[model samples]
Target: MTGPHALKPFLLAFPGPLRDRLVAAVLSGEKTATTGLLLEYEAEKEELPEVGERSALIDSDGREVAVVEITEVQVLPLRDADLRLALAEGEGYRSVAEWRAGHENFWHGEEMREALGDPGFVVDGDTMLVVEWFRVVEVLREA
Candidate 1:
């Protein structure tokens, strides 16, 4: 809370079934890491998250459900994502390839594409990615 931005919103994804599922995972401590596109940060004109920084995990209803502290932050090509990160996501992926495929499907979905403001946007291995690891600091909602 000492940073320029005291607290920011940590949104997982577009609201709906997927967001609900991801929120549930975080609330239950099943998820500790998440992947994001570098373009997203650029698009929003937001600074990249840093280790030790905290943000409010917002739910679909715009509620600050929890406070999560960033423990790690890595920026790399999507192709460089490894098994450790794949497992850290807590999405039950058995391999890195599976993880990439699953995420590709998500990134290619209508909602994500729409949010990116490029209906034809497509992610490739060379795409820049921001992978972050966070820990739940406090639960604001009972879940």
Candidate 2:
């Protein structure tokens, strides 16, 4: 597995606004109950090899926002099952189906999809990457 040090550069180079938008869209819902709408953003700032920065912000509803934190917009070699498993474990879900159900419900099902627009996609072989962007306000954690 790659260490945080190895990933730190990539994470730091990610775009902030993009990360915020995605986090807002993903975290906005009753089921999810995210502390902030601002999550993390990532995007490509130029045609150069790798260029960008990661940022955190907050939304109007007083939520934390992640902005422009993604440098590479390509797909990672993780399957849907793997992604689901990782999300479940990270989000403290018992199963993939449970996580999916929560997402669907929290995202307001298909209706919400129409409002948010179609999902982004960057497919490479079996890998897939999604890109997005948005602005956000920052939130400070309690000591």
Candidate 3:
């Protein structure tokens, strides 16, 4: 049933460190074009999912950091006629519950809390900040 607000949430979950790196790249303007970064990351994937896909995150050096599972891929075709046709044909209905359920299985069920608690080292110019335990819950992407 499509309505005024018929959009699903898309999560771009990444490893805590990799997320931080991307955030830094954004803030620093080093990676001015975010789309390029996404493309680069996407290219590194060895395989794609059959249904709604997920990806394994890689660091700047192309090393595996974590896995990113796209639980849902809601297509909102802008053309009203197209959308209407899609809705009428039952083409947009997809169960995301199974995909959502797999998140726990990724990374040993390590919640964001646990990732933050691990030791982290941050360097700022000549100064360095070594945090024994840090807690951060920052949204990477939502669309």
Candidate 4:
């Protein structure tokens, strides 16, 4: 217990308010799913999460607040992103339009742009997404 935890870090977003909200959602069971651009995994050379895989949910302050187990993972296009998935994110999007609108804002944010090394990067219908669903297994800490 003196060193870093063994599980890989499962981060929802950047380290700030956005991530804080996301962590809260996960911890409270309001959020059970998340979507990420396939481009991000490609850029980082990361593999897709498999069913039953476990990870440490790292919060904005670098604390492992919980352990999450992946239940499902789907790779689909932006056009295929559905309301069910959106609703599971627990951000209170009532429609697909609302979800896409919110996601577009984040996908086009400066931090994401910088991470992708493209200031003008934009998401489109053809854009691929890695939609993952997970359940919190254990909560290690609180906010």
**Per-candidate RMSD, Å:** 2.5, 11.7, 20.8, 1.5
Q: List the residue pairs that clash in candidate 4.
A: none
Computed on alpha carbons, the lDDT of every model, listed in order, comes to: 0.91, 0.33, 0.29, 0.93
TM-scores of the candidates in the order shown: 0.93, 0.33, 0.22, 0.96
Whichever of 2 and 4 has more lDDT, that candidate is: 4
lDDT score for residue 7 of model 4: 83
Best by lDDT: 4
Clash count per candidate: 0, 34, 0, 0
Candidate 2 per-residue lDDT over residues 1-143, each given as its tens digit: 13553222112112355334434443442111121101112232223223343444334443333332333333232234344333422345576566545443534434333434534422222433232222222223310
TM-score of 4: 0.96
Better of 1 and 3 by TM-score: 1
Candidate 3 — which pairs collide? Answer: none
Q: State residue 8's C-alpha deviation in candidate 2, in Å.
A: 18
lDDT, candidate 1, equals: 0.91
lDDT of 4: 0.93
Candidate 4 displacement at residue 61 in angstroms = 0.7
Selected candidate, larger lDDT, 2 vs 3: 2
Give the range where candidate 3 is weakest over 10 consecutive residues by summed lDDT. Answer: 128-137
Better of 3 and 4 by lDDT: 4
